[model samples]
Structures are given as C-alpha cells and as structure tokens.
Target: MPQAKDHVYLDHNAGAPLRPGARERMVEVLSDVGNASSVHADGRRARARIEAAREQVAGLCKARTRAVTFVSGGTEANMTALTPNWQDQGAPYYLDRLLRGATEHPSVAAGGRFPASMQEVIPVDANGLIRLDILKDMLAGGGPALVSVMAANNETGVISPLAEIGAMVAEAGGFFHVDAVQAAGRMEIDMDAWQADAISLSAHKFGGPQGAGSLVVRSTARVPAPLMLGGGQENWRRAGTENVAAISGIGVAAEAAEKEAQDWARLAALRDRLEAGVREICPAVTIFGEEAPRLANTSCFAAPGISAETALIAFDLERLSLSSGSACSSGKVSVSHVLTAMGAEEATARCALRVSLGWNSTDADIDRFLEVWPQVVDRLNPEARNRAA
Candidate 1:
C-alpha cells in the first residue's frame, strides 16, 4: 500500500520501512523456485542464497557464520533460545531456572518454554535500568540459570548494560541470551564483548521483510536445543522449508543497515529536536528513561493530562503514524508495562507514547509532527490548552 502524500511515519521500533535493496532482493527470489533442502541444481542455488544471508546476519552480530540459525522472527528466535535444554559440544547442558528483566518484551515475559515456578524477574530501577545489586543477589541464590534481557527496550529505547550483565551471568556460571531485535541494525553487536551465549534478531525490526530472522549463537558447540525437530534443515537446528525470499531480503537489509549506522547521529539530532519540541509545547511532559543511554532514533514521552488513546486518534487523523507504545498489543492502546516497571503511576503510564525514527526519517518528518503537536494538545487537553493561551 502506498503511503499518503502527507503522512509521516515515526514508528521504526514497531518495524522499519523495508530497505529498497531488501525489497529488490526479495522480489528477485520470489520469482525463482526451489526448496533449500533439496540437492538439485535449483535447490543448490536457493541454498547458496540462504547461506550467504547467514553470513551477512553473522557479520551484523560479529559472530561466526556457522553460529547463525535461521528462524521465523524475533519471537521464534527468543522462544528457541529460552529453553532448558541446551548442549555443549552435543552433550546435555541443562539450565535450572530462568531469569528475565521485568521490563522485557511480552514474549520474554511469557517465560518462553520454562514453567512459571522456574521463572524469576529481575527488577529495573526508576530509570528503566536493571538493578545490578538485586541481580547479584538473585544470581547468588540460583543454580545455572538462563538470563534473558533485551539489548535495547522497544518502548523506552533504553540501552541495557549488556557487558555488565553478561559478566555477572558468567560469574554465576549461567547462560546469557540477548534479544537484540531492536538493537540489531541500530547499534554495534559484539557477542564476545557482551559474553552472550546467544542473541535473537528479527529482520523486520531492521529493514528487511517480515517473517525471517535468526538466532546467532556465540559457539555452535554451545547452543540451545533444537526448537524444531522434524527435518535435517538448518543443520538440524530448525526444521521447515526456508522462506528463501524473506531470507534474501534479510541479507540485503543487513548489509544496508550496517552501512546506515554511520548516519545514525543525524537521527539522534532529529530525536533530540523532536523531544525538545514536545517539551516546549507541554512543559510537563515526562520523557521515559530520559537520563539513560537510549537509541539515537527514539523519543518516548508523555505529556501530563493528555491521554495517549485520545492523542493517538488525533495523530492518526492528522496522518501522523507513530505508536502509544508497543505495536504488539493487537491494535489497542493501554498502559505501558515498561513504564509501570520503572515505577510510573497508572495515569502517567497510560499517557506514554513512543516516537522512534529510522534510516529514512528526515527533519521534515519531525517538523511535521511537531507542527501538529499543539493542535492535538489543544483538542484533547483543554485545561493545558487554556493555560498555554
């Protein structure tokens, strides 16, 4: 679907616009026919494409090409990683429990394959940072645990201290898995530096087409147990026919996103300007995780007395596309769990809105949104409007 001429998109964290290179690659693959599992000449070509994509994804994470296991998307990648059964050079390496950040995505909050009794939550500070002292105490009481945390938060754009968290997990002799879905193309990913056992990524979160992703393990020898178990696909790691077209798109997008990271500072400046504009209009606006290091392209804030649900409708009518929080909530606006975990009150949490930028986001887009801001406030918040007048 073509976007309206006047519409502006600012919801990169929900899913980035597909890169042109990725779109072209996907189109090329869609016209071809071959199952990657087959050994015929046609299949060999498809297999080569998949392998090449794996290498590109590995390069994004600074991991060995052999460590990348193609999956459906971020959710599947996380589910495949957060399991009790893992192997060290093909031997049974079991984890006794699961520990995840309280502000994690809903997929991580579900505890994946672990039972409720075996799962624990590590609290975050008021600024949405994980409490290191509390995490240290929790680790001391647990057996070989699997600690799952996102490299960057989807709602607040807060960057976690992955290296520190990884060191703590290593000291506890536990496994570490990072959901780098939001951080994949936006930030540098060094699996070794973070000492992460595995990191999950979704192609769509970057600039690829949806439906393709990967779980990149630090070592193929020490990987999670096979989540899918029917065929000898993905080196027996995951089963099912590969989405060759989507995988091709992922490779192209990965290559492009790597190049695009250099221009991220420009996006950061735009985000800063966007936030400043919001604060200027609504001086009482609260920016979540404002003091923490955040993704350069994200600005999540809530103005007091302006209901997010009401503002969203106004924004939509104004042809401004953004989100109140995570787009995963099936088209409904509700209180942000991320804000709540950071000790925000229910009223303030409900007002939270996330404005994330992307590779193609421009100053014009930010200006257009800022231009529409006061009108939205005036319509939904009459008291604030009167005070401003």
Candidate 2:
C-alpha cells in the first residue's frame, strides 16, 4: 500500500480538485471591494466580472447568457427548477406535482418530496437509464407537472437520453427539467438540441469552487415561485447577496473545462484501464453500466461478498480514495439507489464502488489502483477471495 503522502484521489465524481486558475480568480475577486449589485464604479467592475463568469458558465452548457441564474449549489438549482408554477390561480386544483427518476441524487429526491402527494417516480433499466416508456406513460396521464431527470447519474455515470425525453415532455405540455451537474464538464450539452426547458449545474463538479451553481431556464420556460424570499438578487428569481468570489471562480473553471474537451478522451482511457485491470485481477468483479454509454471519467463496479464500506476503507488505506455512492451519503453505508434501480440485489448493491477520474488523472494512477485493489479486496474478504482463487 502506498503511504499517506502518496494518496491518489479517484473520487472526482464526488468533486474534482480545484483547477489552478479557479483559485487565482477567487482570490482576485476576494481582494476586490465592491458589491455586484451596486451602481458605483467599483460595484460596476464587480458586476462586469460576475457577468463575464455568467457568460463562461452559459457557454459551457451552450445556453443563453440570460438563461443562467447563479445559486448556492446543485441542490438549490434543483429545488428552484422543480418548484411548481401555478399558472391558473382560480383553478380548483392547485398545480403541484414532481416527476423524478428513481436513480436521482438525494437532493432531487428530497426536492420531489417537497410536495408530498405529488411526487412520482420514474423507473430505470438495468443500465440505470430512465425508462422512456414509463416516462411517456406518465406524461400521457399527467395533469400540470414537472419532470426532473438527470443528464448523467452520479454513481454509475449513465447518461440519459435527454433530447428524446425533452421532446416527450414538450409534446405533453409539461415542464422538463434536467439535473446536468455531473454532465456539465464531462459531456456535451446543447440546450437547444436537447430542447430542455430548464437544467441545473454545479461549478465544483467541473473543477470550480464549491457553493457556486446555476439554473438555466429557457426564455419560454415558466419560472417557478421562489423558495427563498429576501433582498432582490438573481434578477429577483433568487434572493440574498451573490457569492461573487465563488461565482468568478466557477466562471474560470467553466472556461477551462470548455477549452479542454480532449481531456475526456484521456480520462476515458484511464477509466477503461482501471476497469480492465480490476476484471483481470478480480474475476468476480462486475463493472456496472458496461452495456451502456457512460461518462468518460467514471467506472462503477461491484465485488461480490465485499461491502463497499470495506472496499472504501481498504482503498483509503492504500492511498487511493473512491466512493461507495454519492459523497453526500458517504457515511451511511447504504445500498446504492442506482444499483437497486439497475435491478441489482441488495447484496450486490452494497458491494458497489465508484472510481472516477479527472483532468489530473494519469496512467500511473490507474496502475497504482490496479496494484493495490486485489490486495485490498483480499484483506477485506479473505474467505471470498480464497473461494474464488
């Protein structure tokens, strides 16, 4: 096992290491003295910086500059997008309904629960892709509704067919919202091509600062009632003072990510190498979403009879950090919702580990993980290893 000083991060899906330029941008913003909303000269300079950042973020998603509304994080973006928009105040039925994929992140799940009676779950296939047939059926039977589907899953990295889903939602006259936090920097997202009404993204997912995110809403899309009410900011869509430093950092990160699309190919190759090595050394290991297209940097797999908790600890000991599931639910040691949605048994679900790469990943990182993984698994589940051997 490598020493602590040599620890390698393989949990980029949780959050990537901050880019070199992102920190510098944040520091520069912090050193400035001005409110983004102020009309004064200094304030105007800050506002210009904020607008520049907004353009960079919007460019990454291929969205209009006006479409991006900065928020605290992915959770806030999702909540803002999912909140019901009551068009007819006089109608007997107060319009409140949320449609979400079963494999969504906890934030989406929690937001779906906000309107308790209105929450509907969309099922997923064995590859963790949402069932289009099920979605179509729901849309067909729906009243006023909002459908929340992720562009790419965090745990398994399965990319959803958003363009088709968006068309279906548009046909049904229901709002379509996409959680594109994981897909923002990793995959190509063209809002116009997808025809999505709204999409959510987080800067930290793309090597930007934490606490900075955005909700991109099409011009024709109906804006939901604000969840928070206070000082007018975010064009009165979101309240409270903006985090200028974080926003600036996010913009820098977005610009860098957009300019570095070729990095995905390298990360994909490294991910494939890691999966191949795991399968070769540990024959019982099963790679999740192998039959489907996935994010270039992610590889989620399972080793039977070895719990994800044990594997995570073993990996940590070897100076290789990965995840059992979403970083938000790390300490819970629960079965993955993505795996369960994929039809994995509870035992199999509990044994899953997600290893994700990023811009900083190298062939040596993959080799280091390959060298340590088998020993870690053996140490964690000796009886199972012996049986397999």
Candidate 3:
C-alpha cells in the first residue's frame, strides 16, 4: 500500500475531506458544553451558535433562515420530506400520491411514508434524464402529488432540470422536493428560481462533518410533518438535542462552499482530461451520462471486460481511491440503478466506475490515474492487450 501522502482520493461524491475551517469549528464547539434547549446563559450561547449555523446553511440554498431544519443527514432529510402528509400554513396539505424519479437515491426510492400503493415511478430516457413528457402525464392524473427527484444523481452525476420540473409541479398544484445532496456545493441553488418546495443537503458531501445536514424549504408555511416527534427542537419539525459541533462544522463548510462554488468549474476540465485519457487507453470505453449535464467533479465510466470489484481492489493497492457508484451500499460492487434506469445492459453497469474530484484535487492526481489506467486495462482485457500488441 502506498503511504498516506501518496494516496490520491477521487471519491468526493462519497464524502469530501473535511475542510480546515469546518474542523476548527467542530473542535471549538466540542471544547464547550451547553444544551441549546436549556434556559441558562451557556444554553443561550449554544442556541446562538446553532441559530447562526441555521442561517449559514440556509444561505447555501438561498432559502429563508427560519425555513431550515437540521437533520441527522441526507437520508433523514429525504425521509422527512417524502411524506404524504404536510401542512400549508397551519392547514392540512394532503398529498394523494408520491411520484419520484426512477433514478432517485434509495432513500427517496423507498417512498418514505408514502406506502408502495400510493407511490409511482417516473421514467428516464437513455441519457439518464427524466422524461418530462411522462412526468406531465403523471401529474395530470394524480391528486396533488409530491414529486421527488434528485438535483444531481450520485452514481452518474447527471443533473436534473430542477427549474422545469419544479414549474410543472407548481402548475399541477403539487409539491416539489429536490434531494440536492450531490448538487449543494457544485451548483447554484436558488429555491425561488426552481420554485422548489424544499431541498435536502448533506454536509459531508461538500466537506462538513458526516452527521449534519439540513432540509431547506422555500417557506415555513409549507413543510413536511415531523418524522421525529418528542421535544420542540427545530420548531417541532425535528426533535433531538442539537449536535452543536457537527452543526457548527456544517455552517463553516456551507459558507466556504458558497464562496468557492465558482472555483468548481476548474474540475470540469480535470474530469474531461481523465475521461479523455480513459478513452485513449480503451477506445470503446463507455462514459455514462456523457451527453447530459453532470457535476463538474464526477465521471462515471466503464471499460470492456473490466469488473468494478477487481478494478477497485487494484486501484486501492495502488493508493488510488475510486468507487463503482454510490458509497451508501456498504462497499458492494453491484449494477448501478442509475445506469440501469438509463437502459444500460447489466454487463456494462456491473463494470462501471466513478471518479469524483473536489477542492484539493490537482492535475497530478488526474495524471496518476491516467498512468495507472493502461495497466488495469491490460491486466483485465487480454483481447485488448493482444490487439495492442
């Protein structure tokens, strides 16, 4: 195994390295002791910190400060938002159905509180983009539905047309919930522009602590019912003792991400270079969602006769961190649902690999990956190697 300094991390979609400011803020909060719910001075101080963080996190999505609710992570935020029952300004706003994108994260795919019978799947085209015409038809038939689609797919990095989808939902008198965990720091988030009812974000996806995330809504008047019930924390939406350190870390990360968002365009050049190098090595390599808009830092591709499990292990031994797809599956190398939804054959989906870069990624890192690619290809594909000879 290579030394830590030599290792190249290309899995930012899994979780970015914690930013220095986020780490510092976490340490600062951990050094103190205070309960945000307590009435004492210490408690008040803690409360102030949490509130400040709330504002910072909200700013990341261009949302109202009061509309933010701190949740455990992305999964919790999705579960909370995908509910059939919601309130519109203190009145019951019931959703008769849950219509979600076929390529949504597993959290949203599970349909949350909406029973299987009440849920429907919206299809995607071969480009991994939602079939909006089908979505229009689905909306026409359903009673005020809750439309759930991710802002950016984790596996393929494909970005959805959020503004268009949100407009359709609004016109149909439905609620639009965007799982924006992957899009948070990579794209501009304007709730007003998208007319999104709410969007979920995970701090870890953008360089904060893993446990902290937020569900930012366009309006507190329209919000999901509490998934966690007990105390009155989070304005009765989510009830638990505040994780001050993690939340503080999230604030620092959110602020940094918003300011640094413009710099991400540089990663697209790096990603293009990486993909071009792969294609040069294996002329027939498949790049998923290549025709669609994708996250600047991500590239998902597959080479013939190369299995993800083998490549991942080989890459790890070479001190190159890569992934087959989403890291949520406990490291299993399985066919990507995102690819499958886009009509990829099982063999191609099984061989898929994802390389994502972030703030610290450098040209040297991409160079290293290209240098290692040919060896992996030669070892895995004897036919290609013989042809090369």
Residues 168-282 of candidate 2: C-alpha lDDT, one tens digit per residue: 8888877778999998778888887787778898988889988889988765235656666797887777888888999999999998887665457778888888887877766
Q: What is the alpha-carbon lDDT of model 2 when measured against the actual structure?
A: 0.82
Ranking by TM-score: 1, 3, 2
Q: Per-candidate TM vs. native?
A: 0.98, 0.93, 0.97
* Shift in Å, residue 323, candidate 3: 0.3
Distance (Å) between predicted and true CA of 265, model 2? 1.5
Error of 2 at 28 (Å): 1.0
Candidate 3 stretches greater than 4 Å from native: 1-3, 326-328, 385-389
Q: Which regions in candidate 1 have their CA more than 4 angstroms from the true location?
A: 385-389
Top-TM-score candidate index: 1
lDDT of each: 0.90, 0.82, 0.90
| Model 1 score (lDDT) | 0.90
